[model samples]
Target: MGYLYIFGTILFTVYGQLILKWRIEKYGSLPPLVKDKILFLLQLLVDPLILSGFLSAFVASIFWMGAMTKFDISYAYPFMSLSFVLVFILSVFLFQEPVTLYKVIGLSFIVVGIMITSQSV
Candidate 1:
């Protein structure tokens, strides 16, 4: 059940990251002018998808809180790295982002680290 909380955290974290990227891509590049930049960000803030992304962050935090109750932070925090591994894989496919060999290796290390740390508890 505690692992479920950690899973929930990973899923929500991935959703927030992907959603924000998708919505921002729709808006195109940031404006050069300072005033326009502020307005551009304000517009994104009001966007429903963007709002949901932000909300997902809040939800992830709640899940983290739940996870903390069930295990030592050292035992559980490593699981959060799954979010990065997932988001990295997901973005490459979902967003048509490039995948490099170095990135794959780096993420592989993170997964290995999680496996090692998961055994420490």
Candidate 2:
């Protein structure tokens, strides 16, 4: 069950990050609000991508809390680093981002780290 929770956390984290990227692309960055900031905020909130991302993030937060309750932080936190690899893959497929050798090497290291940490757990 702990492993399941960990996997769920990883999924939630990855999906949450992807959604955030979608939101950013759809809505762009939040500009400095000098005046009529409330209207700007409202406009930002009305964006579908932003709303979906926010919802996914909220769900991820809840799953993360559940995972934390089920496992030691030391064990669980390292697993979250899986997001680095996940984001890389997602970026390549979803956004047509380049996957270079350096990125592959970095992702390999991330996998190695996760393996080592899993051994400890």
Candidate 3:
């Protein structure tokens, strides 16, 4: 059940990020940071999709806090790295992004590291 909370954290985090990216892509590029940055940020806040993304992130934090009560941070934090693996695979499919050899190798290392860390617990 603790693991479930961790996975929920990962899932919502990924969903929030992807939704933000999708909304940004669809809405056009952001104004330059130096050019009316505050207004640009305000505009982003009112966007429904971006608001949903923020909500997802908020929910992820809630799940993460719940997970923290169930296990040591050392035991749980490494599992968060699984989000990178998931996001990478998902980005390729959802965004038509290219998958490269190095990406595969790097993701494999993440999996290996998680396995090694799990052994200590």
Model 2 TM? 0.79
Task: Tell me the spans in candidate 2 whose CA falls farther than 4 Å from its real position.
Answer: 28-42
Colliding residue pairs in candidate 2: none
For candidate 2, give the lDDT of residue 102. 95
Q: Compared with the true structure, what per-residue lDDT tens digits does model 3 show for residues 10-117?
A: 999999989988887876766787667778777888999999999999999999999999989998999999989988988899998899999999999999999999
Q: Name the candidate that leads on lDDT.
A: 1
Better of 2 and 3 by TM-score: 3
- Local lDDT at 17 for model 3: 86
Lowest lDDT block of 10, candidate 2: 27-36
Ranked by lDDT, the better of candidates 1 and 3 is: 1
Off by over 4 Å in 3: none
| Clashing pairs in model 1, backbone N/Cα/C closer than 3 A | none
What TM-score against the true fold does each predicted structure earn? 0.97, 0.79, 0.91
- C-alpha lDDT of all candidate models, in order: 0.94, 0.79, 0.90
Error of 1 at 114 (Å): 0.4
